[model samples]
Every structure is written in structure tokens, then in C-alpha cells.
Target: MSVHAIFLSMLCILLGLAKPSSSATDTFVFGGCSQIKYAPGSPYEYNVNSILSSLVNSASSTSYNNFKISLPGSTKADIVYGLYQCRGDLSNSDCRDCVAHAVSRLGVVCPGSSGGALQFDGCFIKYDNMTFFGVQDKGVVMKKCGPSIGFDSDGMTSRDSLLGYLTAGGQYFRVGGSGNVQGVAQCVQDLSMSQCQDCLAEATLQLKNQCGSAAWGDMFLGKCYARYSSRGDHSRDHDSHDDNDNDDEMQKTLAILIGLIAGVALVIVFLSCLAKLCDRKGFFHISSKEDPHSLKAEIQEDRYIEARERK
Candidate 1:
């Protein structure tokens, strides 16, 4: 076979074998511990763990994907309040998975802080010794900005449009945009509609102040999240909540399919060339009795006469 044929066959085989298996990915976005620390193995630590366990259990088993629970201790000081909220775009299973990861990460990152907030791309988790449910925490736990891009009106305008849609009858959670500016904003479920809007607005203002020229930015506050990207789909407009997720998944599936098809096509071409080579080498010689008048028979007769004359 030609060098090209052999190389193509090997490449195809490698591609076929290299298909990636579907697996869970970590969704950790950010996390923080309160300045207050609890003694290791103290009753307070035990209480926190107990509260985390309940939150995790409820998150895993619930269909709503938003839940808050409080565990009262023997003394009021041991009481722990916790809650988890999944991004509206996530499916039930995805929400659960994100919450589970967030909860586990909180233990490692915050340890015994009386109050800790764990945020993921798909969910948010927080716990405190003091009650925080229904109360908006104006504290800014995390703020991030994408690298600076040339600033223009589209960036701010698109972000504001997206936020407006979210606050005004966008179910308090929304994803939308146009051109190169797309964004989403969401609030914890315990908050009222107005409270959700206020929290998102506050977060958006913070992002504007900190990352006005950024290609993308996000602000994770006590009870809400607001973000926009000037360069990515987060900035691009979408028809629905899951549109972005579905688009990503579809793109991935298409890439794998294209790879598989290209690999298979290369393999078929290589095999065809190999078969032609084998035929020329007489590995599949025609039977004389089956086709006595065939081209191979005439060539063999000429070869026999030439050999006799040489003898």
C-alpha cells in the first residue's frame, strides 16, 4: 500500500479510539470564609457539618432545586442556617450535581467559618450561624473581570437590556443579549421579586464600576448574581433559558460526530487501496476453470511460452 494509505489507516484508528467518554465536570466558580473562625472539633463545627449534611441531602433528593433549612442546636449559638440555589437554566440532575459539588467544596474552603458562601457556575450554597434567608446580604464576596476589550456603548447597553429583561417579568432569572454583549442575572429563591431585582441591580452596578471595559465580568453577592460578556455567548442573545447550554452540547456532539465520520472515511479509503494492492499481488488470483478467456489467463499463457523458449 502507498505511504498515504498506511498513514490514513493509522490516523483513522487513533481517532476512533480517542472518542471521549461523557463525564461530570466541576462547576466551582468561587467561595469564601467569614473572618470569624470556629475551633476545630468544637460544637460549632459539628453543628455546621450537621447543617451541611441536611442541605446536601435535601438538595440531592428535592425536585425543586431550591431549598433552605435550619437546624436548631441545644443552645441558640449552635444553630446553623443553610440554603442552596441552582441556576435557572440547569436541569434537575445538573442542579443537584452542582449543589452537591458546592456543598463539598465549602467544607474544604471554609472549614469552620460561621458564615461561608460557595458559588458554582450552576448553583450557589451558603450557611451561617445567623439567619440569612429572606435577607439580602449586600456584601460582595467575589468580583471578576475579563481582560479589557475596546469599550463601546453596545457593551453597557446590552448588559442593561439583559438585566432589564430579567427583572421585568423575566421570571427573576434570565439570559439574553444582542451583538457581542450577552448576560444573565439571578437571585436566591427565598427573596421576593422586588428583592431579587434590587439584588441583581446592585450587583450589576458593582460590575459596571469594576469592569466597565472588560470583555466579560461577574459579581457574586450575598443573594444574587449578575454577569455579562462582551465577547462570548453570555453576551449573545438567546431564545430561552437552556438555549445556551443546549447550544454548547449540540456543538460538542457535532464535533465528535464529524471526527468519527472523518476517521471512518479515511479508514474506508485505506482499506480500498489495500484491497487493490492485494489483487495486483495475486492474493486473489482468478481460477483458470472459472474464466479461461480472462486477461489473467492470456498473460499466464504468454509467460509459459517465454519460459519454455528460455529452457
Candidate 2:
């Protein structure tokens, strides 16, 4: 098969493996596409398209809670770096769905952009044209808090204990509850111990300073995220056989059905484009007068322009 055909086949397999789905609690948090734009026919654009499939595949195929992949561009000038991290409480299936949804959503939101990041309640995904691995980004990307319900001593204590446990432990993440208060703290796997500590400290400070006295709060930083809640039994029981869990499963089933339909549609589109290219260049006519190299170059230009137009 041709390179394009291989890419399409790989995409189909990855989409199937991802089994894109959503649950009652799974919701889009926030994300931003980079401002840097690539020209219609630039190598950077090609690299982005080529590597996106691999990134999504890597993210969904892993049983581990976190996944990261980096692919060099066709040339040395550009590369694609990507990573996905699921919350500590999520199941592997749920994690795959979140990551798949994130990959698709971020691609649409930032079409042809050089970089982007998307965060959901259960997972986070990010990609860029440069090497961002092992780097600690302390910047605050987002912060949100529930309505103030005044101060609760138990909540504050639990939150402190959560952070304290994370600081003392060697793990990159911690989740637990004390009394009626529940909290979670996590740092990306790429961070060093010291870097993770610094990020958690900054995140904790932001959670306190920005979300004062709120019943529930979440702070997303460059390399870490912290959350706490004091609003009625916030602890999650992943193994519970309850009505809410059933509803969540139903939602996931529907989401998976929709994703499969979308995947089929994408395959149709890709095949159509391939057919047109083949016909336009007389691919079956080896003795045709047209130069194969020129036709391929034209096809590349066409794809780039189409991508830009869609954006």
C-alpha cells in the first residue's frame, strides 16, 4: 500500500482501539491552541498531520495512567511532541475515551496550529512542534471554584493533609479524603521530584489564594493539577453498582457509537480524496505523460490548502 493508504489504515485501527466514549462525569474543562500558524504547504503542517495519528494511538493503547510520544518531522526543522495523563481514579477504558475525545476535540479547535492542550475532568492532552518533555511549566493555565460556602475546618485540614502526603511520598500523585472532605494532587510524570514538589506547592498556593472558602475548587498549572471538595461525600467509588454508574455507562456507550460513526465518515472522506488524487494524476496509467513527482507535489499542496480552508 501507498503511504497515504497506510496512514488511513492506521488511523482506522487507532480509532477502533480508542473506542471513544464519554461518561456522566466526563466534561471538557478548558484548552487553548497555540497562536503560531503554519503556511499552507509548510513541512510543519505535514509533520503535524503525520504524527497526530501516532500520538492518539499511543495515548489510547497504553494501560498505564500516563502516555507520551515524540515524533521527528520529515526534516530536522520540525517535530511533534505529545502526552496524555488520566486522573488517578479513572479506569483504563474511561481514560482511553477521554484521551481520544481530547485528541479529536483539540485537533478541531486548533486546526493546522503548531501546538495545543486540552484538559478534561478525567484527563489532559497536549501536543507541540517542539520538545517539551521533562520541562516544568509553572504557569497557571486555568482556575475554577465552586460557590463560597464559608470556611470548613475539616475541608481545610483534609486539603492540607492531601498535599502533605504528596510531599512526603515519592509518588507523582495522591488522592484521599479525611472526614467529609476529599482532595487530589498530581504532577506530570516527566517532572523531577524537586520539580514536582515545586509545582505542587505553587498549585496548592494557587488553590488557596484563588479559590478561598469555596466548597469545591480546581487549579490547573503547567505541570500539575490540584483539586478539593467539601460538598457532600465527594469521594468516588469506582466499583459501585449504582444507578449513577449505570447512567455513566449508558452515556459511554452512546459516545462510542457516535465516535464509530464519525470515524467511518472520516475514512470515507480520506478515500474520496485519495481516489481523486489517483484519477487526477492518472495513477493507473504508468505510461501517462505527467511526471509522478510533480503530481505528488501538487497533491501535497492540495492537502495543505484543504487543511487551511477547513481551519
State TM-scores per candidate: 0.62, 0.63
lDDT of 2 by residue, 117-144 (tens): 8887777777787778789998999888
Cα miss at 83, model 1 (Å)? Answer: 0.3
Residue-level lDDT tens digits of model 1 in 204-271: 88887898777778888888888787655552222223655775776677667657766777787888
**Model 1: residues with Cα > 4 Å off, grouped in runs:** 1-25, 39-43, 61-73, 154-156, 235-311
TM-score of 1: 0.62
Least well predicted 10-residue stretch by lDDT in candidate 2? 232-241
Backbone clash numbers for all candidates listed: 3, 0
Provide the clash count, candidate 2: 0
Summing lDDT over every window of 10 consecutive residues in candidate 1, give the lowest-scoring window: 232-241
State residue 137's C-alpha deviation in candidate 2, in Å: 1.0
